[model samples]
Target chain A: METSSPRPRAERARQVADVLRQRITAGAFDDGPLPDEHTLGTQLGATRNAVREALGLLRAEGLVERRQGVGTLVVHPKYGHGLDRLVGLAEALDGYGDVVNEVRSVGIVTPPPATAERLGLVPGAPAVHLERLRRLGGVPLSLDTTYLTADIGVPLLDHDLAGRDLFALIEETSGRRLGRADVVVHAVTAGPDTAALLDVAPGTAVFALDRLTHLDDGRPVDAETLHIRADRLTLRATLHRGPA
Target chain B: METSSPRPRAERARQVADVLRQRITAGAFDDGPLPDEHTLGTQLGATRNAVREALGLLRAEGLVERRQGVGTLVVHPKYGHGLDRLVGLAEALDGYGDVVNEVRSVGIVTPPPATAERLGLVPGAPAVHLERLRRLGGVPLSLDTTYLTADIGVPLLDHDLAGRDLFALIEETSGRRLGRADVVVHAVTAGPDTAALLDVAPGTAVFALDRLTHLDDGRPVDAETLHIRADRLTLRATLHRGPA
Candidate 1:
């Protein structure tokens, strides 16, 4: 719906695109191709021009594609990853497909200063360093690099990392449950190495998550940095207002 | 810290950059310029070559800059916004600076289909629409477009929107305590118009937040789309792990 005052065409297009994007992601068009621009315009009570512009925006986002004769089609579907829960990639994407971890590297090494601090490791102490290329349904989703305290990390080196989540392995090995995590989420342009791993063009926007996970006793044990493909994952949260 | 096996130089640089970026954002360099590459390399237990490349990476991210005569300097400080809490921009950046809202437009209008559905308005029902350019310390931070149910939104026009957050005004006007919000966060390239408003170049990566806030009784009242400058804000959260 248009505002009372005249707004820029681009803004109007964005509004329409927002609505269409939500509907597309919600599987409104799973049965068949999307309606024509004229139909979408009438359905959303937007101008035909705005609807066309909105479709163009969606096309650029790689969510939908315009075919010469097949009409508009939903090209990619993004999976929602809940940010309120401290879950592993496999647990988070449960029911989507089997999340396979390709363990690129795993060894005992010196962690960076910040990682060492987060994991509460003593200076000069060795920690387990693990690098994984995580995939869902055979498509790369994230590149995860993790540092763990030596006590628990050393045991994980012998576990089946590809078939199970690290959280599970940590608990099984140390008998300590994961309690919580402090996470920082930001957008970063994909570098050449990351882009190659995630199979995206260099400079594409991706979600960078830096997290420090703690044991149930409040001892930090895991520090991870994850570069997730933005087009494939959406971070979701339900937040409550605290006292002012 | 280097792994036991040799890794790519670029990957090593990224690891160093991550640690340095965290330290920079934590105000580790407030007293002076960053240490020389050799000193930093020793501090982080990385090679001088990797430290040099790390500084280069930070320079590209606009987090740090290297001067010809002077040393590296932290260019921009990012404000961390708690994603676990439902608060206005002003509240999120309380200690940073005064968050001023520049109301670009406010009026009653027909909302898009999804907006109307989210707000639970009947077909053809009117809702209050607001567009605000939010700034921190006189610099643009976010572009907020909001839609509210008519019952709570109609009276907001008379409130001091520019000086106060909408959450405060909504509660004051509707006499309804706000409860929770559903938020979705992702990254998008800024369009030409949005880039102009946020004083960034076109195609700059920005955080796009879509939120639907509800009243204490679970009635959704406010729906918003926020385009936040990525360099100026970082989203933080403390997440708990649920039972397996």
Candidate 2:
């Protein structure tokens, strides 16, 4: 949304910024730091001022960060999501590398009245509560909390989650695979606990994904709340006019 | 994300809050105020304090607002976008009633270098730019900025918007139907201008949707930026195994 009339000299900086934007979006620095401004200037044959301006624009866009001694680090190259995928968050970021599931806790807890209602159980009934931090390359991506009814909850927590997917593990333990989920998406600000785990300031905007996963027999198997850091990830959804 | 052991007395308030959340998410009060504390208590058969706490939770969740003299007002009842609808911002909120498109400005100007590039035009080439504030029931919902290439831009601006969809008008004026768009979604903070128009505090989190719409012949025809108030909008996207 530039308002001033454009000048030819500014083209150099614009071009530099455009190429950098492409690299950031392509996940080129998924695990590494971006090139230093001096290096970019030399390689692109642009002035140091041009490279500086380009990097400044990127920082404003929240794509990269400059630490005191860390130099210029690509803080978050967008997590590009296609609009048709229905996979789990772990599966969605598999291509980005180092999708680590850090299980904070696994135990039976009295379900929240809302969670019980969602799972069609008595209020305050016991349920399997799994709290996890999904990290990519050691940087936390999301806080995932999954609640399962007693039948599935009891067996699922008995086994430690190996390298297998969470959904796959639930299937193995409960002897039933979840078929589908009714999902609700919310744009919310992170609270104290969630903000701490995601390494964002409290009240930072986040994406809250609430899902009720059901079994093949149509019994509600699990209710999950995925709180995703908005700066680190982006999601797409398709809108169809009428039913196909 | 509650930690304390559940108390029996809290159950009543929790139930009250749960029902309120459902109504907010369903856009049940798009243009009205939520019932007052005493009224809610009478309706839900809960104590007044319980109603107060329930409303407090909804406020923290950014659903309802407690105006001093206006009582509790529903602020950001999530705008559930199903994803496939290609309708304009006005049409998208038609269900909410009285979607007003207030054009802030419309004129020809030198496009931002990046926007010009996307439109396949030389730097500083003239393009029609339109800035608008979308209001639902006199409440501002989003700030929309649309840029049209000269071929379509010149003719489109000659007439009033006249309750027409921007894309539909582009096709009417240029005789070319637009096709797909490459959309980039960003969870960003609103700047002073946008924050003021949406009547929200400055730096409030918002959703930045930048889209480059193309013609059936694969020619990029328009570039638009829509800044939606997070308090008012919720977007959903899907994920799949591999590239579709």
Per-candidate iRMSD: 3.0, 7.0
Predicted structure 1: clash tally: 0
Model 1, runs deviating above 4 Å: A1-7, A30-32, A242-244, B1-7, B30-32
lDDT of 1: 0.83
Candidate 1, residues A106-137: lDDT per residue as tens digits? 89888877678778887878999998989987
Instruction: Report lDDT per candidate.
Output: 0.83, 0.68
B111-221 per-residue lDDT for model 2 (tens digits): 655567778988767888777678777888877777788888889876656456687677778877666677665665554445667888755667766667877677887
DockQ of each: 0.56, 0.23
Q: Please give, as one word, the docking class of candidate 1.
A: medium
Candidate 2 all-Cα RMSD: 6.3
Give me the candidate number with maximum lDDT: 1
State the lDDT at B82 in candidate 1: 90
